[model samples]
Target: MCRQIHPNLAKDSVGLGGRSKETINRKWDELAICLNTHESGATKNGQCWRRVSLCYILLFILLSSLIDNFYNCAESYFSL
Candidate 1:
């Protein structure tokens, strides 16, 4: 996810080239704080949720494929 540029900082040159070092450093500090907060909340329960969801999706795919193969084999056997 991308952060929106602060209005005051947006008009300046990219990379904060035209701004004072203090202002640029302050912006970087703000960005770091935002990232830390976002990650902390996400990590609290996100890991387990992601793992469970991924496993379920993969299991569903595998089961569907197996069912399709079984149906094909049954169809051929019956047609013979």
Candidate 2:
């Protein structure tokens, strides 16, 4: 970000004038290109895939149990 911006500052400070809007825009595009070039592509947590899948499975089990308990209570109320 700084490398892209510094050229414009030098232009204005030395009477050369800041980058033209077009030049600034091109610099911004290049900056984005450079920034994205280094991406590792994986942005998730460090957990292994199997552990993550197991966590989701356990969560589903707990949620199903809650739903079953709720329906059981409703059924008992309707029976009464």
Candidate 3:
């Protein structure tokens, strides 16, 4: 949580030699905490969305290919 990490980060930022490392570590920790706390359902939702979008893209491509094939077939039939 932000509440837990903020105080430590504030303290670390005031220190000199290892401040950069502490800040980076704190940021990574914050990211881990946030992801652990918040992304449980959201991660599933995101994957689901990606799958659905991929399906839609595949369907669109299939439909377009079918339409193109049909158009070519019709053109050849008319020419013959």
Candidate 4:
């Protein structure tokens, strides 16, 4: 679902952004139709996609594999 909307980011395309809003809207509409056709049970309303941004949230994470040992470093670095 997401990959369809942001194909360049998902696949690492290096293109600059100048595409019109209508193009993005059409992509969302097409994706909604495709998902509906597959019986995936996701929302068929393309507008629903605008309400959530899983990709943007994922971009905020930087800890990854270092989280388990985070406290070990923090113990000596902080007064907590």
| True-structure RMSD, every candidate | 12.6, 16.7, 13.6, 5.9
Encode model 1's per-residue lDDT on 1-80: one tens digit a residue. Answer: 23765555333223555566557446545644555566444432333443554578789999999999999999999999
- On a 0 to 100 scale, what is the lDDT of residue 34 in model 1? 55
TM-score of 4: 0.45
- The local distance difference test score of each candidate is 0.59, 0.55, 0.59, 0.56
Query: Where's the lowest-lDDT run of ten residues in candidate 4?
Result: 8-17
What lDDT tens digits, residue by residue, belong to model 4 across residues 1-80?
53454664233333435655556666667666666676556664655654444445465455654674697789868966
Q: Give me the runs in candidate 3 sitting further than 4 Å from their true place.
A: 1-44
Which is the leading candidate under TM-score? Answer: 3
How far does residue 13 in candidate 3 sit from its true spot (Å)? 34
Comparing 1 with 4 on lDDT, the higher-scoring candidate is 1
RMSD of 2: 16.7
TM-score, every prediction: 0.45, 0.42, 0.46, 0.45
Sort the predicted structures by TM-score, highest score first: 3, 1, 4, 2
Q: Model 2 off-target regions past 4 Å?
A: 1-47
Clashing pairs in 1: none
Candidate 2: tens digits of C-alpha lDDT, residues 1-80:
52544455224232334646555445545544544466675333322332454578789999999999999999999999
